[model samples]
Target: MVELRETRIQTRQRVQPDDTNNYGSAHGGMVMLWMDEAAAMSAIRFTGEWCVTAHVDGIDFRAPVPSGDTLYLDAYVYDAGRTSCKVRLRAYHEDPKTGSRTETTDSTFVFVAVDDNREPMPVTTLECSSEESEQLRAEAFAAFEE
Candidate 1:
């Protein structure tokens, strides 16, 4: 009974002096923040109400994003439950001059809808209407674990 939607966002921030550690690289938490923001947007779009981060399944930092790179984030709600929506997020690091991109991290976050009284609310059903959407559905199902 939960409606699901998909959304995406992109960000590029230099590993500024404040955004990095002594190693001159972005912190894992900072990257997660971006991912969370993007995923939350998708959840909200799907539910049309305030949503809360019920859980973060996990985050995998597959590659390192250096100081001067741009971080790109893509997030979408690919699946839904009665009151919960499952979202997939992917982060990439891009070189400005070379226009090269590398995937840095990817994760799935689950969000719950909250009404004005902060009670759990049901979301609408999700529809996959295109080849791209079907592909996303397959990928989501493949990633789903029992």
Candidate 2:
């Protein structure tokens, strides 16, 4: 078994001019790319195998991240099947100097572990190592219930 906390991944990216859209906010596609990468990292960490994104559900963009803000992405595995891992992904925009953050987007991503031949392979069960990890897993399940 792999502990959920052990697979938790966080990444940061500074939103540069090139990462923005014409509206001067972070581009939706760019944000999705970042989310995918983070989610993949969580899945790979849990399974110890290459993982590919199978689905992204309800990608809600709640706010815009203006250029020059730091984008913080957090991801962790919440559930696992025989060959798939369900990851919860969230992105927040922070003022680099002040350190205030606002959630910009959130989504649930599913990834399938693959072998060297690219065939789906079984993954170990996920275990929550703490109350917080358990709470997060519950919240992820609740989000999908809606």
Per-residue lDDT of model 1, residues 1-146, tens digit only: 33232443444556665766678777888888878888898888887789999999778888877777777877778888898888888788888788788988767899999999999999888887768777876776677654
Query: Which residue ranges in model 2 land beyond 4 Å of their true spot?
Result: none
For each candidate, what TM-score against the reference? 0.88, 0.96
Return the clash pairs for model 1, or none. Answer: 2-123, 2-124, 3-123, 3-124
Candidate 1 stretches greater than 4 Å from native: 1-6, 9-14
Which numbered prediction scores highest in TM-score against the true structure? 2
Cα lDDT computed for each candidate against the true fold: 0.78, 0.93
For every model in order, what is the number of clashing pairs?
Answer: 4, 0
lDDT score at residue 117, model 2, on the 0-100 scale: 97
The C-alpha RMSD of each candidate to the native structure, in angstroms, is 2.3, 0.9
What is candidate 2's CA lDDT for residue 49?
Answer: 97
